[model samples]
Target: MHCSVVADFFSILKKKKKNVFFCYAVLPQNIGTLHGLFLFFISLFPFTLILTTDNNYLFTKKKAKKFSFLVVWVQFFLARKKISNSTESIMDNAPAPSVYIKTSPRDSEVEKAQNINSATPFVTLPSLPVPISRGQCVVYDQEVLICGGLYTRDCYSYHVLEKKYKKICSYPKDVKLRGHSVVKRVNSNTNDTMLLSFGGYKNEKKHTLTMKYVSVWNGEKQTSNCNQWLPLMDKNEDKPIIIGGDEDDYDGMRSVIGGSNNHLLFITYRPKNIDVFNLDTFQYVNRGILPSDNWIYFHGFVSKTKSELTSTSTEANEKKSEMILFQRKTGLAIEYDEDSKSFDFRKLSVFDDMAPLSEYAHVCINDTILFFGGHGGPKLGVSKAIHKYSLKENTWVKFEHNLSTPLSDCVSVLSEDNTYVHILGGFNDHRDEMTIHVKTKATDWMDEKEKEKMQIYNREKELEKEKNRKKLQASHFFCCCLFFYLCCL
Candidate 1:
């Protein structure tokens, strides 16, 4: 019986040709241990050949059991080799996104004389399906959700790894919205990232102020055709809870500073109020006022708070992030605290030496926050510089690499693995919507490459200047000799 089974197995293996390992890999993952061992024992070439040649050959149960013990190690080795090779091949062929816009050129002499800092390193990816600005966005795992923007109902999810924008369901209803506030709901139980959106001008006329009954979207089900903006429900009730809007709630763009798991902190302009909204209670817990009501745009980072349960309260275990809200014309800034509900001058050590910039796009990678192009001047002004703040070192640096042109009113977000950054649609000085994508430099190898290229650029310029100087000297000597000869004649 064993001899006949061996002949059948060898016949199958022969039909498979040289793809023996592929057959092994295709084995069902949940195969029972005893069944798998029996099959593996039959796969041995020597025993199979013996069975095929000699029908009378005695097969001992002890030998078969001993041979099956090595099957697990053999199976593991073959599967691991195949998987590792496939992984390496995929990584090697992975796409590297590049810059798309033509950067505004700068004269080397001017750059040197001014002693100006350079921009941050960036790579351009695919543009958004539509141009947008002054919208609300939040980082959720691998994607940044652009909920809604001025005069447009289109909402998009910018995927970092894929380097593309996918228009995921538009805002519910016929009314378009702009200047809204969107924040990720903390301590969410579902695998999908839950988001709460509030405070946008509906139809560019009516205000949808407050978080009382904010519209909620789940990442899992928020598809391209999904048009539902469901209301947040009460914890105890099966019915939907109406989000209440305050009469005094200002309807405009809100800057998210940082907040605890149960709370969200934001700084609102015009009124210049810093308020904290509780996630559990779905209401405002604390509110503080800013000194100047100036419309200085704020950019900040929120440390990813822990989701694990502990003895301490969630708020006590987490540290709130500092904000970089400052005026462009006047180099003044204000830092707010969510815990104390207090405001003060921004860390003067960092802001004192910083240039006045506004409307810049910023994103966090590792321990650093990168600020991109912003309002460059008085009216309709935009900038082309990239500033980096290192949270660990407490130092700021300006890199030579920059956006293709002056950019402002754009949104930027970091990837889940801290490997890429996508700067979404914004506008230029000409008021042209820049529906472009940008990536930040993440690796030390990339930095070295940029530095090497710059050195080569400088060396080439120096050689060209030296060659021009020699030519001028020769021309001068010839002119002098010609004058002397003419006088002699």
Candidate 2:
């Protein structure tokens, strides 16, 4: 029986008229373990030999188990040989991956890819419902909720992923907001996300003021096409809390900062006071007054430091704490100490020579503060420059690129990953939306040494590619010769 099986296997192998020595050379040394199973399979399925290839063999699970050891050995042998012969060739011929490095192409004939303009970096998107400015937007899930900027109660939700806009529930009948601070807060008790809109001018005259309103959308209760805006009431008073009041024109300057536990800290303009709102109780309290400086239209946000949390005993020690209020302008930054309640004003060491700018769209990304186009004086009015301030380096670098349009009062939101910044509805005549792709990091602006290293690295790659081309040519020739020899056999 064993002799018959062996004869049948060889007969089947011979019938294919393949290179027998080539097959033997490629077969794993561990083929002795699969010899019996291989013979059994050959006896069972005479056609199995036809499926064998220089690199691979196909078998069903059951048949595969019978020849498992042989399959592994064959795979190993083929993989080793292929990798040994192809490694250098592949590395040399394949296009190098894109890297964030500055280097000129070695071959002058090779066209270099265009560098993204850092100055007007924003790519325009679809226009809004109307030419709106000073609008407030809050990002919820994949959508951005825009409310009351064009002197109308026009509320719309923009689907960021779909690039489509759908009008949602309008603001309350009396509430029209522009230049408001909109924040998405979660209800700790019910765990529902709530949209909080606070402190904005009401009309084109900028006379009326809309203080605060909370809107909630229940997808289960309401249809997918509509959402209901409900007034958030103070638990004790049974009335909606008026934030900053109807008299203060705190447009474009209200900022929500850090709060502990269920409490949230909000800094508003005009009064320049910190208001603490308890999410758990729906109550508001006046905490501390900011410096009595002209804080109008200035940005403020809470920045926490480790020292602030650790130094609890004395006000002097608390001054060393990390909790700070960061305010910015074109050439100025005012830092407020949260613990000591002191203000420290510093002229921006860099870009101080540039004209002072205001009403611009700004967003904090990672350790950098990006200032988009804002209004400057005559020479720099409605500026298009995109200035980036590095928090770590304490320096300002103005990007040579500019915005597509010179804009002010544009709302800017950084994507969750900090890859793109979306600017919407600025002072431009058309409600043009734009996105700036944030690719180059602060460190990627290479110096001389880095640029030289990049050049050397690219040259080495070219040499490797040349070597690979030769190896591939040899491999093709060897394969062709082997094929011809097998055919003759």
Predicted candidate 1 versus true structure: per-residue lDDT over 304-363, tens digit per residue:
212211235455435444454444433223444556755564442344323556667776
Clashes of each: 9, 10
Candidate 2 lDDT by residue in tens digits, 1-489:
001111223543666744322122222212233443543443332222222222233333245446644554465445445444544543354433221113324323222212335443444456777656776666665566776574657777766445567776666666556556666665444435666666555333222222222223323345442355555566577766555545556666656544443245455555455555555565554455555344546453434322224425555544332223334332334444544444454444436523366667776643456777776656556766777665546777787666666777777765532335667766642335332222232223334543353344445545654455445434544554454344445
TM-score of each: 0.56, 0.53
lDDT, model 1, position 81:
48
**C-alpha lDDT values of all predictions:** 0.49, 0.49
> Candidate 1 regions off by >4 Å?
1-120, 139-144, 159-164, 174-176, 186-188, 201-228, 235-252, 257-267, 296-324, 327-346, 349-355, 377-380, 392-394, 443-489
CA RMSD, predictions in order: 24.1, 18.2
What's the CA error at residue 167 for candidate 2, in Å? 1.3
Native-vs-model 1 lDDT?
A: 0.49
